[model samples]
Structures are given as C-alpha cells and as structure tokens.
Target chain A: MKRVEGLTHSYRFSWFALILAALGSGVLLLIVAPLAALVLSTSFGELSQAAADAQVIQSIRLTLSAALTATLISTVAGIPLSYVLARKEFFGKTALLAIIDLPIIIPHSAAGIALLTVIGRRSLLGSVTGGLMGSAAGIAVAMAFVSVPFLINAARAGFLAVPERLEKVGRSLGASPWRVFFTVSLPMAWRDIVSGMILMWARGISEFGAVIIIAYHPMTTPVMVFQRFNDYGLAYARSVAVLLIIICVAIFVVVRFLARPTQEAQDA
Target chain B: MLELRSLSKQLGLFTIADLNLRLNHGEYFVLLGPSGVGKTVLIEMVAGFITPDAGRILCEGQDITNSPPEARDFAVVYQDYALFPHLAVAANIAYGLRARGVQSKQAAARVRALAEKLNIAALLNRRVGGLSGGEQQRVALARALAPRPRLLLLDEPLAAVDIGLRARLRHELRCIHQQTGTTFLHVTHDPDDALYLADRVGVMLEGSIRQVATPQELFRAPSDAAVAEFLGMRNIMTVDSASEGVCQVGRVEIHAALADESTSYVWIKPEEILLSRQPFDSSARNQFRCVVAGWENSGPLLAVRISSGDLTLTALVTYESFSELGIDAGTELYCTFKSSAVHCF
Candidate 1:
C-alpha cells in the first residue's frame, strides 16, 4: 500500500511540474522570440553598415553620454536620500515615498511636459539658466526625471538590508558618523547601489517619449530609431535597433561582471 | 569610572525614568534583568547611541551627555557581535585603531596581539561571515578593545552562543576584563550570566535599577520582592501581618531574621529549604510537616513542591536525598530552614 501511494505521489509531482514548465515557456517565448527574430532578420552587412553610419554613431554616443550623466547625477543625489528613507521615520514619510515613485507611475510624455515647465524656455528655471530646449542637458534631465526612482528604490532596499546594529557598533568604536557611513554602510550596500545604477542607466538609454518631447535635435538612439522607422521604413530601422541592442547587451554584461562583489564583499 | 545622574528617556510605550547608576573603574559590572525592562535603552544611553532626554553622563567627572558616540571613549560588544561582514577578521580588529588615526603598521601589531590573546590568531585572515558564534564573539571583543576604551558595554554578549560556549565565553570575559583593566558594563536577562561573570550585579526592574550589590549579596539579600523574584528565589509569599522578626503566611508562620513591622512579604531560596522523611534535631528555627505536591528533575537537583496546610513551598534537594526521602506527590515530609535564610521585605 505504501509503495502504491509513493508512486501516485511521484506521478502527481511530475504532472504539476510539467504544467508549470509549459506555462513558463509561454512567457519566455513571448520575450525571446521577438528579440531572436529581430537579430536574425538583420544581415551582417546591414548591421555593419548601420554601425559605421556617422549619424547612427553620433546618436548612440549622445544617448550613452546623456544616460551616463543622468545616472551619475542620480547616484550622487539619491544615495543619501535612500539611506535616510531606510533608517528614519518622520511625518509625511509615506507621502514622500509616493512622490519618489511618481515618475515611474506617470506617462512618459507627461513627465517630459512636467520637465519642460521647469527647465524649458520662458519658465522660471529656464529664464535663470537660459533655455535648455533642444539641448543634451534637456535630454539628461528628462531621462533622470523618469528613471531616478529605480536607483533610489534599489539603494533604499540595499540600505534597509543592513542591520542598524552594525552602524551603531561602528559609531561606538569611535568612528564618526560620516566615517561609519563610508566604511560600514556604503561598503555593505555597495552591490545593491551598483545594480540600481545599472538599472537606472539602462532605463535612461531606452527613454524615447521624454527625450523627444524635451530635445528633438540632439537625437538619442531611441529617438533616431523611431524617426528612421517613420521616415525610411522597418528594414533600415531594424538594422539600427539590432546594433543598439547588441551594444547595450554587451555593455550590460561587462558592467555586470565588473560589478560583482569581491571575495570579502560576498561574505558580507 | 562612569556615572549616570537621573538619566531618563521616553521611548514608545516604554519609559526609562530617573535612572541613576555608578560604575567603578576596572570592575566587571552586570546589569541583570528580565527581558523588555529597557535594559538595552539604558546601555545605549551609557554608550551614547541613544541620547537621554534628561540627565548628565559623567566620565572621570566630565559631562559627556551631549557628545556624539564617536567622542565618547567607550566601545560596545553587542549580543550578535555585529562584526563587520565586509571586512576580514584582522581588518575588523584594526577598524577602531584606524579610525583613531593609528598607523597601519602599529594597528596591525595591536590586532595581532589581541587575536593572540583572544586565541583567534588562526582566524585573522578569514572573513567574518562563516565564523562560529564563539569566534565571532572573540573577534568582536578584540575589535572593541583595539582602541582600549575606558569602558566596555556588552549587551548580552553571550546570549547567542550555545550553553557550553556561553560558559567558556563568560570565563573569557572575566579574564579579558582583568587583563585589559577596562571597566566592563555587561547587560543580560540570564541570571546565570550574571552569577558567572559579574563582580557586582545590578537588579533592573521596570526600567530602573532596583538593587546593586555583589552577586552573593544580591542572592543572600535582595532589596525587594521584585529583586528576589528576578534572582530566581521563587518562594516569595505574602505576609498577612508582621511583628518583630516573625510573619504569618497562610496558615504557616515564617520566622525571618530580617523581617520588621513594615514587612509585607517573605522569601527564601529553594536550596535553603531541607526536605526529609523524619524531623531532625537541628538549629533550624522554621519547620513544617509538608506533603509533597509535585517534583521535577532540575539538573543535578530535584525541585520538590510541598504543601503544609493552605501554604505551598518549593524546596530543592539533591537527587540522593530525593530518593532517600522517597519524595513524590502525596508523600509526607518535613521541610525546615534557619530563620536567617528567610528574607522579608
């Protein structure tokens, strides 16, 4: 009787696993199938030609530079705010968190419009700083406005994972608050902050509606792809899209490799 | 030496009010209490991690109440050790020295000396993540002692270790206190930790220090019922009335050498009560013919609960005597103790 029961149990386990695999493959294929088709459809000659094109190269450079700028600025400003959110409780804390998440929730074009009212020509900040419209700075601002929440939230989670007792021990050891932050808190949370920066940079690189509405002349890669698809058709645009995806993936892989925690950090 | 004068803090739902304590230099003082008595808050206040709402903390006659934790020359070894997970054991030991602007070469020497003394020399190069609980504790001790602070605050440093390791660590803590000559203020809820480690123990209750004395004194004479109860004397009985040195408890009368007219409760350590099958001709002033109500094996001793009329008493006896007396539920026995063993408050 026990043998028969065990057999039936094994049979049920296999059946459940098979169902899970089948359902999982549907979502996996939905993502991989299109990406595979896009890469395969573009010939090597077309990919090389698109990569060598001066306009395509310039747009990619602009996209990389603007996204890098946005990511750097966000990392510098967001880490302190993230640590505060992780370690403190105060009035309006929930509301402040909602505000931080607003960029991710709002439509991209609306985010762009919101950016314009502050930094566009004839606005208060714009008049003080001269116009930012049609400039790379405007593209960076728009990308940052939409993507910064990723970095803040991720870093906040990183800081949250660190036990407050560790920081207290650091301080009691005669290390100042700032020293404790740099040596204890930052190193422990380093992996999460790095991952958050990568996510923010990737999100900024893929921004289109915000960048287009804010700066059209200094065309980013996504904006150029959209314009090329509208003006020259899918074949021409597919080559550029393929090149961008390849470059982004390669850089992502390299950064991920470089960002892995050291032996000591892994122990942490 | 350290002193806290009228230290008070209002934490959520709990308040540590008008707490005052004094610590002599080069002594191992333990703040012993049950859990959730705000012991951690008081320790943190002394360590300068949590600021007291009202009071002054004096170190060598200098007020340091408003100083940041870094400015206070005190180190803490938390219950979980809180070793820096991102650093090697050597690095963790050298951290406080590095913060104090000590050169790497000098700091490395101090770290090695500490590791050698703590018997963690083999673990210097290893990361803290995979260390045994006892090893982590030694590393934490080394790190805290690196800068040689005036006082060391240990918040239940042995609470996480296994029972055997805890005993060994307790011995090591005493050795370190004597070797370093650093005033140690260790806090714990476990009375065993207090009994095994402390040169002097303070009984904390309701967020205040109720009594402070040597461990023997705290055991022999607790200031109040709360102190006696916390000290593992479970035989506290309410007195109906007290006159001179005798008190009435239920139908049985207890003669206490320490009882006075104002006494409302009488207490005796379970081990002080003797259990026997026959009455003995001895110096015991209090005696009762009790029926064994229940008994439990408590390690090497047997804890027997007995009833005499309407009053119950817990008496601890050696297993040898337990079997000799044939104590079990409904077994008639005589329990006796000297009048001096019964404390009244």
Candidate 2:
C-alpha cells in the first residue's frame, strides 16, 4: 500500500511538472518562431542590401524621428496631467480620466478617421490651419493623439503609487511645490515614466492605420512595408520587414539593458 | 512661542471650528486624540500645508497665517518618516539647508553635526531606502532638526515604528527635544507618548481641545467624563451627594470630598483602589466590601473586576498583591481608595 501511494504521488507531481513545462515551451515557441523564420530566410547580404535601400532607410529615419517627437510631446504634456489625475481631487476627475483613456479603447482606424475629420484638409480645423495633410507634423500629431494615453495612464499609476507623505515632507522642509515636484515626485516616478515613454514610442512606431489616414506620402516603416507588399511582392516586402524587425529588436535590447539595473535597484 | 487663534476649516465631512492653542518657546506640547479627530489636520494647518478658513497663526508674535510653507520657517516630521528615496542620507539631511540657499560647505558641516547628534553619522552616504525604520526616523529627525526651525510639528512620529523600538525612539525624541530646545507641537494617539515627552498635553476630540494640562493633571483629574474615559479611567460611577463629604452609591455611603456643588459623577483610577484580604484600613475615605466578579492577568498587573452590592469597579493590582490578598473570581475583599484620588465631575 505504501509503495502504491508513493507511486501515485510521484505520478501527480510528474503530471503537474509536465503541464507547466508544456505551457512554457508553447509560449516560447510562439515568441521565437517569427524571429527565427526572419533570420533563417534572409541572408546577411540581403539584410545589408535591404538596410541600405533608400526607401527602407528613409522609412526607418522617419519612423524614429516621428516616434521620438511624439514621445517628447507625450512626456512633457502627459506628466503634469498624470500628476494632477494621480494626486489631486476635483470635480469631474473620474470623467476626465475616462476621457484620457478614450483613445486606447477606440478602434485605431476609427481614431484615424476621427483625426482626419478634425485635422484633414477638408475639415474646419484643417481649413483654418491650411493643410497639415501629408506632412511630418500631421503624422506626429496623429501618432501622439493615439499613443499619449498609454504614457499618461502609466505615469499616473506610477505617481499614484508614491506616498503623498513624501511630498508633504518636502513641503515641510521648505521646498516649494514646484521644487517638490521636480526633486521628489519626478525622480521617484521616473522609472514608470520612462517605461511609459518606451511603450508610447513602440506604439507610435507600429502605428500604420492612423498614419495612413492622415499622411501617407511620408511613409513610416510600417506604412512603407504595406506599400512595398502591394507594389512588388511578399519576397521584396519580407526583406524590408526583416530589416525593420532587427532594428526594433536591437533598440529594445539596448533599452532593456540600460533600464534593468535601475529597476533591480528600485526593487532592492 | 506659537499661537493659533480662531482657526477654522471645513474639509468634506470633517470640520475644525475656531480651534485655538498656544505653545511656549522650547516647550514640547503634544496633541493627544483618537484617530480622525482632526489632529493631523490641525498639525497641517500649523505647518502651513493647509490654510485655515479663518484664523491667524502667529510665531513669536509674528503673523504667518498667509505665509507659504517655505517662508513659514517651521519643519514637520510625518509618522511615516517621509525621507526622499532618491537622495542619500546626507543629502536628505542637507535638503532643507540647501533649499534655504545655504552654501554647500556650510550645509555639509551642518548635516554632519546633526547626524552625529542623532547618532546617524555612519549612515550618511547610504540611500534613504536602505535604512531601517529607526534609522530612517532618526535621519528624518536629523534632516528636520538640521535647519533648526522656530517650531517643529511632529505628526505621530513614533506611530509607524515597531513596538519594541517605540520606547527607544521615544527616548531619543525626548533627548532630541531637550538638546535642541526647539518648540515641538507633536500629535499622537498614545497616552504614554504624552506622559513621556510633552511638557503639557492637549486632548483633542472632534476638532476641539477638550483639556490642555500637564500629563499628571490630565491623568489624575480629567476635565469631564469623556476626558476621564479617554485617559483610561475604568471606574466611573453615578453618586448622589448625601452630605458635605459623603456620596451614596448602590446603598453604600462612600466618603468623597465634593469640590463642585453640581458634581454628579465620580471617577477613580484603576490602580488607586487598594485590595486587602482582611478588613483593616486607615483613613482612606471610601471603603466597601466587594466580591471579585472577574479578574484579567495583564502582564505584571492583575486587573480585578470587583462588585460592591450592585456597583462594579475595576482595580489594578500587582501580581504580588493578587497572590498575597488571595484575589480571584468570587474572592471577598475590602476595597479602599483615598478621597483625593476620586475625581468628581
């Protein structure tokens, strides 16, 4: 009886272990498949050529510049709004938070259409501004509009987690409100702010539906890939797509490496 | 000296109506209360974080009612020891000095001197996040005290500390208060804090100072029933004044000195009631034959709940007294307490 009980217990433990291993392996497979395929199919020479292609290079530069601009705008404008939403209490605060998060829940294509209706040439705002269409400025605005909520919400959560007592202490120490924000609140929430910015930049970079509706001529990398697939074929498109993927992966790796130590220290 | 005259504020459901207080220079004044009694709000008003609806705050006869926190020249220490996590211990200590535009050399010197005084010199370069709770508290005190504000407002500084460390930190805080001679307006919910630290204690209830007196006075003779109950008075009995120096309680004529003509209630400290196995006593005005209804053994003291006729009173006795008097449930004993120990209200 003891032997039988031991065998049954061992079987249960083995089954549990097996289930976990299988789920973990499946997740790993799903993640690695596309990257492995990209690497395997493209030769180094083909990658180098694709990297040097003028259209690919232009698209990459545009994507990076536009994403960076959006990130800067989001950081500057989103942080203060996030702080307000996080800390202070006023009338209509819940409604205001909902309004900030509206873009995230809406369909991206609808967001694009909404932007076009407001800022496109035929619209009243567009007519007043006189043609923001097909320009770098228009792309940045559209990307920022769709991507800023992520940054703001992330920053708000971060700022909310910081104890209000810390700021009170700062005030009691004779630091002005502005001084407290800059010295204490800002630094404590910096990790979250940076992570939010990164997420915003990533979202902005990948944005194709909104950018296509507002400004298709400038062609960010994602839009360029779509255009290439339509103009030529999947083979030509794959090379450029693979190149963009590599660039994104490298950037992500660098950012993660730089941010990891600070995160660990914060945890400690 | 600090004075708050007719301070009033209404925040949501809580309100403070015309609260007033005065603290002398170098005196440690403690505000004692239960939670949500506007103690924190009062401290905040004094610290200049929250402006009062109508009032004038004066420091040494200077009106600072409308002054900003930075210009108010007062420091506050919160219960949570709100040290900036991003700064090192030394930098945290030097923050107020730096804000005042003191030179770096002078700030460093001040930080070192204060850190040494607080016994936190060894933790100077360590980050605030790395320090223990007691260490963090000392660092916070060092930082707040380094600038030497005219008044220091402490909002329950020892509330967040561990139980064992609380006594040590209380001693340290008392020492700091003495060494610096800074006027401290401390807020707390613990009577022991008021007893050990404050030169005078103010009991606050519902946004009002019910009574302000020395710890001994507050404990021995609270102003009213609520204040007495708050100060841990366990035995409160209704008494009909029969004569000049006598009162009737449950068919027993207890001798009590009537200080007020309209006195209707009497309060006695639990520890003031003496328990004797034999019926022998001297001039302890009130004496009754009581049976021990129940007893609770609190560490180092036995709390005996005694019933005399229809009236019950709790008395605290030493473990030795409990054993020597053979006190237990249903044990008949004689209870006597001095008339002066009975506070009439």
Candidate 3:
C-alpha cells in the first residue's frame, strides 16, 4: 500500500508541473532582482549625487517629514478611537468601523479625487480654511486619510486583545480613567500600535496617486521616484530607489528585530 | 461604613434589582451565592465601576451614587488579579497613589511598604506578566490596598487560583484585612470563603440578599428553604405536626423542637445526620428506620442517601464508617440527628 501511494504521488509530479512551479518562482525572483541589482550596482558616490539633487532631497525630506507627522497624529488620535471601538458598544459602531476602513479598498487616485472634492477650493472645508487645496497640509491630510485606517484597525485589535478585567482592576486600585488608559491599556497594546504606525508611515511615504493630484509640487518620495523615472533614465531612478530602499530596509530590520525579541520573551 | 440602598442595575438580560446591603467599618462581609446570582454586579456597583440605575450608594454619610471610581475611595481586586501587564510590581502598586496626586517619592515609599507587607518586595522590579498567579494576586492586593480606600471590594479574588493556593491566599487576605482594619465587601460563590474569611455573610439569590447573618448562623440556621439549600443543606424532609414537640414523617413520629409557630420547612446539614446499622440510643430526639437508597464517595466523605417511607434524607459519613456499616443501596439503617440541628423556616 505504501509503495503504491508513493508511486502515485511521484507520478503526479509531471515535468510540466515541475516546469510551471519553477517558472512561477523564477518570475518572482526576476521581479525582485532589479531591486537587488540597484542596491549592488550603485556606489556611495552615485548615491551622494542622487541625494544632492535639489528636487530629490526636497522630496525625500518632504516624504519623511509628512510620513512622520502623519504617523504621530495617527498615534495620538487613533489609539483612543481604536480603544473606544474595541471596548465600547453603541449604535452605528459597525458602520463607523466600515467607514474607517473604506479607503483601503478604493482606488488611490479615486480616494485623492474624493479628498479633493471635499477639501478643494470649491469645497466647504477648503473655503473655510482659505485655500488649503495644493499645499503641504493638503498632501499630509490626503496621505493620512488613506493610510490612517491601518493604524486604527491594528490598534483596535491590540486593544481588544487586552482583557477588560485589567482596566477594571486599575479603576478599583484608585486609578482614574485616563490613568488606566496610560498605565494598563496603552502599554499592553503598544506593540500593535507601533507596528500599525510603521505600516501607516510606510503607506504615507509611498503614496503617489492621491498626493500627486493634491500636491504634486511637494513631491513625496514615491512621486519623486516616478518623476525621476520619467525625466531621467532607469539608472538614475534605480539609484534613488536603491537609496530609499536601503534606508527603509535598515529601519525596518532594526525595529523588527527589537520588537521580535520582546515578543518572544513575552510569549515565553 | 458602606451601604447600598435599593441598588439596581440592568445589563441586557441580567438585572440586579433592589439589593440593599450594609457593611460596617472594619468588617469583612462576604456576599455568597451561585454563579449568575449578580453578586459580582452588586460589588461592582459599590466599587463605582457600574452606576446603580435606581439606588443610592453611601460611604460613611456621603452619597456617592454618581461618583467616578477615583472619587469613590474604594479599591477592588478582581478574580483574575487584573495586574497591569506592562508595569513592574512596584509601578503597579504605585499607580493608585500616583493617580491620586501623590508625590513620586511618597508613591515609591508607599509601594515599597506595600510590597514588603504583601511579601512581593523581591518582585518589585519585575513586570506583572512575569509573575505567577499567587505573586500577581499579591501585587493586585498591594495596589488596591496602597491607596487606603474607604471600602475594599474583592470579587472572588482567589477564584482563579489553583485549589492548593486558594486557602493560603484567603488566609493572607484575612491577615491583610486585620492589619489594615479595612472594610472588605467580598463576593464569592464558594461557601468556604464565606466560612473562613467573613465576619458576616449575605446569601444572595436572583439579585437579592436572601439572608445576611454571621457565618456560623448562616451555616447552622438559614432564614428560608432557599437559603438552606443554597448553603448545602441536603437532609430536607416534609412532616406533619402531631403535637407541640412531635412530627410525623410517614409512619414514624420524631421529636423535634417546635421553635416557629407556623407551617415550616425543616432543613438539616447532611453531616449532622448520624448513620447506624442497628437501632441505637442517643441524645438526638429524631430517629427513624431508613433504607439506604444509594451511596457515593464525595472526596474523603461517603454520601449515603436514605429513604424513610416516602421521605428521603442524605447523610455525609466517614469512609471508614461507610465500609464498616457495609452501607450500600438497599441496606436497612437507622438515621438520627439532634433536635437542635433541625432548622425550621
């Protein structure tokens, strides 16, 4: 019976099946190889030149600053909203959650257009704010609008994972509502919120379509990458892309490693 | 002193209505009941976690019905210990003090003192999540007690601990209460917690306090049939009064004290009933010939179910007596208990 089973399984692995599997894997490798080649081929001097470009520098700085600012805003505002969503029950709560997550499913350019309609000079908020249509604030708002749902959802899951009993105990210990949030809930949900922030920040930094429509002049890193590829050739674009990738990868690796150790220790 | 006057709350399907309780200062009061009896809800109301919809919670003479938990000056220890996972033992203990605007040094000092008292000094720097069940419980207790709240509420604090650790924790809790003179309103379903730790016990059922009495009184004499059954009274038998001192169960007339002048339900603890293989003479006024309907082992005790005519009674006996009497289903035996043991309600 064992021999027959092995023979039948072996027979299923035809040459065509093997070839298909190899081809699939090879395609993925091929897609990733340009990124690898960019990293390998670019020297420090080329990276410096790319970094020295006035537009490139401005875009990189703008991207980091906007992404960081958006992340901070989300962290401050999103954590409480997430906690409320996780812990409270009220009418329209499910609908509210769905609305918060709507941007992730829609097209980025469409999201940008929708944002433009709401915050453009012709719109009510834009008129109230005296023309915030194509400024840095508009870009930040647009990036934040599209990326904030990830943070809120992740933070909500984190808050949900924390037992309600902990907060009750904190209250019973004479800690006020605010104290309990800081002392128990926030700390317990910190890792999830942090990871969520990282994702949101990354999302904000890479945003192209929405940001381009809203504030094309500000030129976030992804928009800059697109522009470089258009104005120059693949080599210059790849060099800048390579620099961005290296910086992001280094940051991602360090943070992930630090978080990984703590998670494992906590699990143990 | 803490008082809950007609305290009521509605949570979806469960409602605690018209619950009135009073806990004197420095008293250890245990609210005992079955699960879902709303004992925890009552305690939570007093602790200021849940507001009573139609009641007044008075601390000393002050009405604190609408007070937030921070303003209530009451601390609670939950069954799960609810220790802050991110805070160190010391930090958790200090949290209450810090929240109430205590100076950092004072909070630290208080934490140190509390840690020492709770015997968690060595664990002061360790995160609460790293501690064992007993250690976490101590930290929770320390945190709750450090603030010196007017009333201390413990909602089955030892319920989640292993059985082996329960007795020790209960003892430590009692000791802590004694040392602090803190008014403790403890909620528990376990009879042992009531018996061991409470100065007084309130037996609750269906969101109401059925009977509130001393632990001994609760065990020896419950206020009603429901209270008796709740306190593990098993030897209940219906009887017709023949005279002032005599009651008839089937064909047998047993002498029992006619304390209450009404048609009453009789309750006796299973352990109070004595089993004999043959007719034996004793001070117990009530004695009847019964057939052993069945027998089962309950931990170290043998639970013998006996039937006298149509009346059935349960008796808890030693394992040795069970074997020596050769007690089994269909064994004929005499069951007797003291007249004083019969509680009529």
Scored by DockQ, the top model is 1
Off by over 4 Å in 3: A1-49, A127-134, A231-233, A257-268, B242-245, B250-252, B255-306, B315-345
TM-score of 2: 0.88
**What would the per-residue lDDT of candidate 2 be over residues A92-134, giving only the tens digit for each residue?**
9999989988988988888989899899889998999986889
Q: Each candidate's DockQ score against the native complex?
A: 0.61, 0.55, 0.46
By TM-score, the best candidate is 1
Model 1 per-residue lDDT tens digits across residues B305-337: 998987788998998888888877999988899
The true-versus-predicted C-alpha distance at residue A186 of model 3, in Å, is 2.7
Q: For residues A1-268, what per-residue lDDT tens digits would candidate 3 score against the true structure?
A: 9999998988886888999989999999998887777788888888889878887778788887888898898789888899999999999999999999999999999999999998999899988997566688888888898899999999999999899887887776667788888878887888888889888988888888889989878677787788878998777787778777777788878877776537433752
Question: Candidates 1 and 2: which is better by lDDT?
Answer: 1
Please give the C-alpha DockQ score of model 3. 0.46
Over B164-277, each residue of candidate 2 has an lDDT whose tens digit, in order, gives: 999999999999999999999999999999999989999998888999999988876778778777876678877665556666766877677764556677878888999888
Angstrom error at residue A175, model 1: 1.3
Which stretches of model 1 miss by more than 4 angstroms? A1-15, A262-268, B238-251, B254-310, B315-345
Worst 10 residues of 3 chain B by lDDT: B258-267
Q: Between candidates 1 and 3, name the one with more favorable TM-score.
A: 1
Work out candidate 3's RMSD over C-alphas.
5.2
Worst 10 residues of 2 chain B by lDDT: B254-263
TM-score of 3: 0.84
Query: What TM-score would candidate 1 get against the native?
Result: 0.89
If the candidates were sorted by their TM-score against the true structure, best first, what order would they fall in?
Answer: 1, 2, 3
